[model samples]
Target: MRTTYLTIAGRIRQELTEITQVVERVQQIWQLYTSTQPRGNEFLVDATALNLHSFYAGIERLLEVIADRIDREKPMGSAWHRELLQQMTADIPGVRPAVLSPETRTRLDRYRGFRHVVRNVYSFSLDVEQIVPLVRHLHAVDAQIQRELSQFADWLEQAAGAE
Candidate 1:
């Protein structure tokens, strides 16, 4: 139905908006990380970790929207994050095509693991070393997500127009 495609297109737009917020937050975090004088201070490190956590949180939120609207599944398990990512890359039965490539999923797993760490620990305890790599790669992941979502948006528009 065209309504289904329209729904997906609408939700994708929402996710893209959320992605913008996520990128803004991540850029802010990266700025804090870079702009700190003599670096590795307590406040900067703690705030950056929390902000980095938000980056992954944003990624998950968008994926949840896609799953709920398009895949019609959200996976239930102790490893639901992994399942959710896999779901995004899977072709749902006559529902919709995969929303992410395996490569993007792999890149996203890094954020997923960081998100898990952020959840279980106190922010002050976050290691600067571990956080550095994710921060460094943040733009790459964000760009990939943007490119992929743009393609999906085009697909949704085409699907909607087919009615």
Candidate 2:
């Protein structure tokens, strides 16, 4: 049981790290895309927009993993990412629910929409308008996750110290 708990904790840490890096990259790209006035070839901007969507997809995957691990002892389960989030909110008091605070929920919603677009290979192009909002949402989610993780880490440390 201890080993299982340790493993899950390690995975949560890993996912948190990945999410942070992705959020940072998304912010950097957003800065680059928004700094200058619209000019030059449209294709380059279009490609960058797609890349931004891809980064959100990556964030979604990480969140899904973290949520799943929180709910189940093992990670090998059905794709219950959404269900897991709901269960987490309903089941775990304070700790896990902190992971899905309002800000995080907004980011997840935006990511869900972007994921749908990417999965369907939708032709709709993303402009600075969409990217800016998404980046802001992503940053908010990142902050929430960081705060939650810190709390979680503290909890783990206290538990370990007790043991």
Candidate 3:
């Protein structure tokens, strides 16, 4: 049981590191897009759209790990993606604290919705107006995720020690 807790905590920390890399890349690409005068290039817009999709996907991966490893239950069905995101906001008594705050969940929900649109529609069809705000708020959302997950990792470590 101690080993299990430590292993899960390690995995969470590892995933957080990888997610940070994705966030940095998103910031770089977004900066390039914004630096371009007029910022209307179709290709840059497409790139930003893809990065945003990747960002949300990375976040979902971390949440999935928490659901499967810690929560011992994963959501099922066509709406599982949304379900999984919501799961992180739940405080499962005696199991684990909520991995995300409701505010963070609300911000991330936007990215999740955008991710679905990115998957279903062609890149050129993406709305720059929508993507712009998501990119602008990326840092705030990422900060919340980092803080929450880091605290969760601390909890895992403490639990391991207690065991």
Error of 2 at 118 (Å): 2.3
- Strongest candidate by TM-score: 3
Encode model 1's per-residue lDDT on 48-75: one tens digit a residue: 6777777777778878877777776788
Clashes of each: 0, 0, 0
Kindly indicate the candidate among 1 and 3 with the higher TM-score: 3
User: In model 3, how many backbone clashes occur?
Assistant: 0
Candidate 3 TM-score, C-alpha based: 0.93
lDDT of 3: 0.87
Q: What is the TM-score of each candidate against the true structure?
A: 0.86, 0.67, 0.93
Supply the global lDDT for candidate 1.
0.79
Flag regions of model 1 displaced more than 4 Å. none
lDDT of each: 0.79, 0.56, 0.87
Stretches off by above 4 angstroms in model 3 are: none
lDDT of 3 by residue, 1-163 (tens): 6887788788878887887887888888878878988857778888878888888888798788879888999999999998998899999999998888999989999999999999999887888899889988988898888899899989999998998
Ranking by TM-score: 3, 1, 2
Q: Is candidate 2 or candidate 3 better by TM-score?
A: 3
Q: List the residue pairs that clash in candidate 3.
A: none
